[model samples]
Target: MQAEAGNRSGLTLSVPMDLRQLRYFVAVAEELHFGRAAKRLSITQPPLSFNIRQLEASLGMELLRRTTREVALTEAGKVIYREALKLLALARDAEEQARRAANGEAGAVHIGFVGSSFLTRLASDIRGFAAARPEVEVVLYELSSYEQIDALQRGQIDIGIVHPRVMPSGIASRVMHREAFACLLPETHTLARQEAIDLQQLRHDDFVLFPRDFSPGYYDKILSLCLEAGFTPHIRHKVRNMLTIATLVSHEFGVSLVPASLGKVRLPNLVCRPIAHAANPSDLRGIWRQDEAQPAVLALLECLAASPA
Candidate 1:
């Protein structure tokens, strides 16, 4: 092989030196005895000596001072031995990382989720996934159901936690949890003190709700539930975040219909009550593109399936 002289170190190196030669050189350099080094490498002395000579020729330098009685490393041999150790270690690490990534035990996954999911078991599910797959990094993004659908289609997120509904083209969904709807009312509201309130009782009440564009399916579902009781809500304000809707209701600006699990949000002056009439349950679903086959995404899906949410 042709060798190139390095400008900085005045060392010549073959363009592609065989790693086996370097290994043999390191063995002999450390042992300082050809017989002992060959035994350590499970080889005979002749082949070991040949490999060391080849390595020295490839680097265009004398790597060893050999005598009938003993062997010792030259200055060039010491430098090459230290560098070979590092190269071998790096090669081993690279192979291990590749294997772990192929098996879905390492790498990063970008996840999108609607805000309300945080109030449910989603947090615990994520925590469990992180604990089980310490090498796999989880990146979180808070997005609306509609936003998640678009992000999934664009390949911006690997997975999404959203309210279950008809998914857009190329996307598939798995239901994670089913939750009932509840009314969020101001503490000073007349019906707030009641154990449970009928949806019809709030017929004339002004409503605070999430913006229709953010999640049209969920927004319309809430409206339909109100209509089933008596009257269509008088929408006074629309916000993009569920928690903010609760904050608005706390100030008595209006009431909102949110997933029952959001009742866990303990805002002062805010109260949540179950609707007396039977209502459609809200579904939390995990969504991904039908064509997605990323190992990280698959591992996260497995985690979600194993955990209750």
Candidate 2:
């Protein structure tokens, strides 16, 4: 590329100019005095003068008209000065953008989550994050806890909101919210009218639950809670989706023990009642790979920490 003067002084300056030389030229052009420009640039006047001479030689044009009395810019010098200012400004902007991305203040984060987490304050938390870091884009994926674990392991997602029984190897997690289990029962069921029902009361009822493989830790916790209530549940229906379980219960398929968040579904024929004797609360955790170093991921974690569910 070349910068050519419009008038037929016929000057065409090639674009192999160094940024440092351009900076020096701009300082001199703006100051109109080599000594003052060198002072402003915190450099010795002799080196500045040599660099300017070299820049003029490379451009094959005399950019400055200099005398003992004063300094002035030639037409080509004036044009070059304006272009140099733009180039320097662009370079500074690029540097600042890179730094912001490195600091986690700007970029993109892929977030994986289970659908039930939305029942808590996950939506509000996401909004808060967006408001806090408007430059960082957040993309969300809805996956089961197990799928999230797999995605995290494969580096497909930056972070996950999951219900993990045990922290997987090389993955780190923190519980963001803890919720007690609730019973989703058909409105016509005997215990549906109770504000809170003991699990023992539903021993004879067929249970609709998430498949054990979906989240063994949570599934086992539900079974243990039932055992503590004095009877083993008769699991007759298995599901993978929390909302589907509620839909099934609404149809009188069976009762289900699910995180209290499912109460928000509020299906027509289903009522979610608290478990009277359940002591363990299902944990919703924020998980990430231990080796993650992305600035956007760190920024998201910070946002998650500031907003409590």
Candidate 3:
């Protein structure tokens, strides 16, 4: 999502109570005595016992076996305690990332992009961003717009460059541009001569498509556009990377529909023609978690906006 300065920072970061409960249970399980563990945690025996019971209830698995004389961990409890420790460590790391993001000191921003997009002027801007913001590490993923959206939802990536579609509820997007569609044809193709090509004329042609996972919305958008022109696109092959797709198109494997920006590819045997009556072409957008407020995200947005294409 594109970030703009809003005076209101309504983000409230919370770790689950089950996590705290797990920690308490682990402390007790490790010591095998509530009194000793309570001493370590600076809490009383009764409360420690209560917290352990609550943890068991939340997890729906018995973690500890306790009696007046002795204490031991149940089989499930032992396994859960090990996993719980890992979860707590991860939770702590996430908290640190959030704090760094708030302070604008250090943080990581994961970015996902479609393959062909990397050849655009935006690619140069990204390199410049990396050089400019050395403290903010940007992890790049070559994914389709659809995969990018899924990654954003799962918190796998902080930002995604994608095409418009049915976005998840808690995700927000900022429209970058409604780029026109370009028809990628082989230099020797019969229809490659004209200044523009009517999409309807390509009805019987074989096509190359981006992987649906990478560009669900955009993928379907292309298909739908062809359908609207009274032809169902004959998808002969699907590839994840646009450059590879273009390379195949250059070899005349099949014609493909791509963003106008793909003209930057400049492959030797590939020619691009504007699509005639191709419905509003794909709109590239930046998407991210609605609850995420990170300076690195804002910084990237600023860089993108300031960049010249």
Number of the top-ranking candidate, with TM-score as the measure: 2
Q: Per-residue CA lDDT of candidate 2, range 154-206, in tens?
A: 98899999886787699998888788888899999998899899888988999
**TM-score for each model:** 0.83, 0.87, 0.61
Candidate 3 displacement at residue 62 in angstroms: 61
Q: What is the C-alpha lDDT profile of model 3 across 1-309, one tens digit per residue?
A: 111111124432232446667678878878898889999999888888888888677555577887889898876666666767777777899898778667554777789986666756667877887787677887999876777877887889988877677787998887654578889999999999989989898998899987676667778889888988899998999887778879999999999998898877888889999998766666777787888778888777767767643
- Using TM-score as the measure, what is the rank order of every candidate, best first? 2, 1, 3
Clashes of 2: 0
Weakest 10 consecutive residues of candidate 2 by summed lDDT: 1-10
Clashing pairs in 1: none
| Candidate 2: C-alpha lDDT | 0.87
Show where candidate 3 strays beyond 4 Å: 1-106, 211-214, 305-309
- For model 2, the superposed segments whose C-alpha errors exceed 4 Å read 1-17, 35-51, 57-60
Candidate number with the higher TM-score (1 or 3): 1
Residue 173 accuracy (lDDT) in model 2 = 88
